[model samples]
Target: TNIKKKMKPIKQTCFDKAILRHRSVIETVFDELKNLCQIEHTRHRSSANFVVNLLGGLVAYCLMPSKPKIPVAGTYL
Candidate 1:
């Protein structure tokens, strides 16, 4: 694909791996927020309740002990 060809140069660098790993972590967090945190629920009776529910999910996510983190690879040393 054209996009792949354009990205070929960057893919040759070691930083590309780190960047991809970081992006994967972000994607995983969004997925978990949408599914596990019930952030996509639309049955709320009022807009105020909806905002409260959304904030609660984000707060709960922030307080979680186990969360996504980038690995500390030896290459960074």
Candidate 2:
């Protein structure tokens, strides 16, 4: 089902809630990668540099102490 700004009460089901939660988590990850990890850049000298920057940002993100995670089956890691 399509997500809407004005969601109707009857249309708010368990599946919809789960989908919305997952989307939010994905957005949060991208935001962190761009803002915290410094992945958003436009001054790359070459494709290799761009790849290196992206990899470095991802590695930095992996080393972060706290990360946004979606729970699986009501369990979090």
Candidate 3:
């Protein structure tokens, strides 16, 4: 209750809405890396190699940009 009292409410803006909307992409990426990519399931010969690979994969994901959505053209009758 005290924690809630100290917290201030943030005003919702376009940027906030944009961040909330795109938050799922990060969640999806994490889900893919954990479950789909099987990055955690490893059989490595060397600890150093494993760490390097893991870091490299994460860096690649961070460096890669999200795919741009294509806009659909409207037809006028």
Instruction: Give the winner by TM-score.
Output: 2
Give every collision pair in model 2. none
**Worst ten in a row by lDDT for model 2:** 1-10
TM-score, candidate number 1: 0.57
The models' CA-based lDDT, in order, is: 0.77, 0.88, 0.63
Residue by residue across 28-71, what tens digits does model 3's lDDT show?
Answer: 77776665444675789999989987887777656666632323
TM-score versus the correct structure, for each prediction: 0.57, 0.70, 0.41
lDDT value, candidate 2, whole model: 0.88
Let me know the TM-score candidate 2 reaches against the reference structure. Answer: 0.70
State how far residue 42 of model 1 sits from its true place (Å).
Answer: 1.6
Ranking by lDDT: 2, 1, 3
Candidate 1 Cα RMSD after full superposition onto the native fold (Å): 5.2
Q: Considering only N, C-alpha and C atoms within 3 Å, which residue pairs clash in candidate 1? A: none
Each model's Cα RMSD: 5.2, 4.5, 8.3
Error of 3 at 16 (Å): 20
The per-prediction tally of clashing pairs is: 0, 0, 0
